[model samples]
Target: MKILVFMKQVPDTAAPISVKDNQVDASKIDKYAASPYDEYALEQALQIKDKAADTKITLVTLGPARVREMIMQGLAMGADDAVIIKHEPAKHGELVEPNDLDGLAVANVLAAAAKKIGYDLIYTGTKGVDDDQGWVGIAMGELLGLPLVAGARSTEVSGGTARVLRDVEGGKEKLEVSLPALITSSQATEPRYPTLKGIMGAKRKPVLEWDIASLGVAADALASRVERVALDMPPGRQAGRLLLGEPNDQVQELVRLLREQAKVI
Candidate 1:
């Protein structure tokens, strides 16, 4: 099976968030890294490739030129090839919220690219670590007119189909679908990391680059569905509230508050 893994370039969650000029000021954010969740998706594809010798794992992403760093990291992990969608990182305050960009435009370009190559399987992380929008896989599925099994905790590909188990709000859901499908893996999923030799060999693999002009996802063709109105850092957190008293006194006071003041009861 051939696979395409959808990846993202996300802010290093480790870096503190700073808001300036009504933007994230991500330019100043230290250590841009692969979206943490996308790491799991990359690992998932690698594991499948290792288990199936015929499988070739490919990576694709839509972002500015700087996104190559994450794509290289994905290559170093075990992807056989990569595709970078070169476009300036559009300001969220100008267009749509960063999370909401997982729509027809981006999805159409990815679908067009992947369909050109003809893949049997596609994988993406459950959500972008930065925005946590949880839409790309579903959107890709829609654009490709394929089925999507999302938030999968585990997946096994066999017999020309994929078996997936996903966690819903509070329970698990099982799905079996034919090949040439899209799946989003959750944190609960486990995929093996690239070994030392695999990492070394990755340097020799292929990475295909394409521009918006080549892919036909021109800016004018991408109609905006939403626009960002404001951007700001979260307010500083307040100190914690502590309720203290003897055990019996605390219980009595809590009960009184529940019944009379707080009215929780």
Candidate 2:
């Protein structure tokens, strides 16, 4: 069996960020990490590889050169090989944030690469932490005309088919799908940390690099459909007010504040 996992590099959630000239100043971020959801996707692929014979897991990512490290990290986590759909900002002579490519563009790029590299199953994160955009996997499935199970919590593959369990409104729903499908993993399982041996082996793993031109994707397909007009941080928290008085007096004061200041009443 051949499996493919789509991964991405994301700034740490706690990393400090600011906006300047309508673009986020990511230089202030001290660290970058793989997307949490994608890690789960990788873990799911690795689990399947462990059980199935002759299974090879390949990691795929789309980003600038800086993201190669993130892809290597996935290799260390046990993916057999990797492919980077590379984008070079210097070549374009402009700074392009990851978000510059909308979900459609990202899906387009991944679909093109997946077509180039055939696979029986494809795995991806349910959503990206940075943008919280959960559209890529489903969109890619649509573009490829394949069955997709988005936000799958658990999956079992056997005899040319897969059974997936996913969260619903108040419970879980199970689905049975044929081979050659896409599954977007979320809360599947805890991601495994790279062992020393795995880390050392990752250095020798092959990572093929491809560009939009090589993929035969039109330039227009890579264009961002949405433009950012402005960016700003949420308002800071306000200090809490203490209502110190008799119970009745406190209630009256609280009601007054809620009615007049908060204006909820």
Candidate 3:
């Protein structure tokens, strides 16, 4: 079985966020890392590959040149090979802003790539950690004319079909689909970190790079569905006040502060 896992490099969630010229300022970020949910998808693929003989787990990411780091990390975690969809021009070291590519364009390019190389199953995060645009997997499925199950918590494949369990409002929903399907993974088992040995071995693994033109996608045609009119940081938080003394006294003081100073009842 050939399983394709889609991933992305996003700004580290713990890093400080700042906006400049309506785009995230990369300089302020401490580092870039793989989107958390994408890692879960990768882990799921790895788990399956561990038990299934003749299975190959290949990772694909669409981003700027720096995205190679994210792909290498996945390689270190045991993916057989990787494909980097170079979003930026062959400008060498420079990285394009993540906002430059939207979900529609990403889905289109991914669908095209999948067609070029057939897969028994495809996996992706339900949404990207940075943009939270949860459209790519479903859109790719639509473009590829394949069945898709979103928010899958667990998946099991057998007899040329897959059984997926997904969380819902009150319970979980079970679904079975034939081969050549897509799954948007949600919260599941924790992702495994790359070991030192794995990291050393990853350096020898194959990492293929391809440009947007090579993917048969036009640069200008990827118009974003949502336009950013302005950008600003959220208001900074104020220092908190401590209420000392007895619990009853604190409750009374809190009420007074809420009524008089806060002006909320």
Candidate 4:
């Protein structure tokens, strides 16, 4: 089986975010890592490969040159090889920051590339950690005219069919999709760390880099429909107040505070 896994690099969630000129100050972010959810998707693909030794997993990413580091991590995690869609502003004039592209635009580029590189199944995270927009995978499925099962907790494949289990409002729902479908993975088991051997082998694995023009996608088609106007940090949390008294008195004071100051009552 040939499985394609979409991966993304994002600033570590713990990294402090600062806004400058209504945009994130990338200079302040010192660390970057794989999108957490994408790790889950990659792990799912790796698990499938584990069961079927012949399965081949390919990591696909659309981003700037720094994303190659994230691709190496994925390769270390057991993906056979990787393909990077270079997001260079000089080459692709319309391309600025790849993350700024809207879901439709990003999906169009990825879908076009996915067509160039065929796959039996596609996997990606349910949402990116940076934007938390869960639209790319779904939009890719639509653009590719393939069935998509989003937020899958687990997946089982056999005889060209994929059985997926996902969470609904109250319980899990099982879905059966034919081959050549897309699946957006949610958290299931913990993602595995790269073994020493895998890390060493990853350095020797093949990596193909492609420019936007190579995909034959028109620049206008990849133009973003959405624009980020500004970015602002969330308000700082206030310090909590402490009540010192008997249990009954504390309860009364808490209620009074809630009614008068907090005004939630």
| RMSD of candidates 1 onward, in order | 3.4, 2.5, 3.6, 3.1
Select the stronger candidate by lDDT from 2 and 3: 2
Report, for every candidate in turn, its global Cα lDDT versus the true structure. Answer: 0.75, 0.87, 0.85, 0.88
Please tell me which predicted candidate would have the highest lDDT against the true structure: 4
Error of model 1, residue 242, in angstroms: 6.8
Clashing residue pairs in candidate 2 (N, C-alpha, C atoms within 3 angstroms): none
How many backbone clashes can be found in candidate 1?
A: 0
Q: Rank the candidates by lDDT, best first.
A: 4, 2, 3, 1
Question: Residue 240, candidate 4: how far off, in angstroms?
Answer: 3.6
Task: Name model 2 segments beyond 4 Å from true.
Answer: 89-96, 255-265
lDDT of 3 at 220: 54
Write out the backbone clash pairs for model 3.
none
TM-score for each model: 0.83, 0.91, 0.86, 0.90
Candidate 2, residues 1-265: lDDT per residue as tens digits?
A: 9999999888888888776666666657677788999999999888888788588999999887888889878988899999998875432223345467888988999999999999999999999898787998899999999999988887889989999999899999999999899999987778889888999999899999998789988888878787778877767899999999899999999999999999999
Compose the digit string of candidate 4's lDDT tens values, residues 1-265.
Answer: 9999998888899987776656566767788889998999999898889899999999999988899999988998899999999984332232223366778888998999899989999999999988888999999999999999999888889989999989999998999999999999997689999999999999899999998789998888888788778768898899999999999999999999999999999
Tens-digit per-residue lDDT, 1-265, candidate 3? 9999999888888988887676676667788899888998998888888789678989998888789889989999989999888776232134335557677878889988887767999999998888787998889999889999999888899878999989999998999999889999996689988989999999899888887678786665466676777767888899999999999999999999999999999
Segments in model 3 whose C-alpha atoms lie over 4 Å from true places: 89-96, 218-221, 239-265
lDDT of 4: 0.88
Error of 4 at 178 (Å): 0.8
Q: Candidate 2's error at 242, in angstroms? A: 2.5
Evaluation by lDDT, superior candidate among 3 and 4:
4
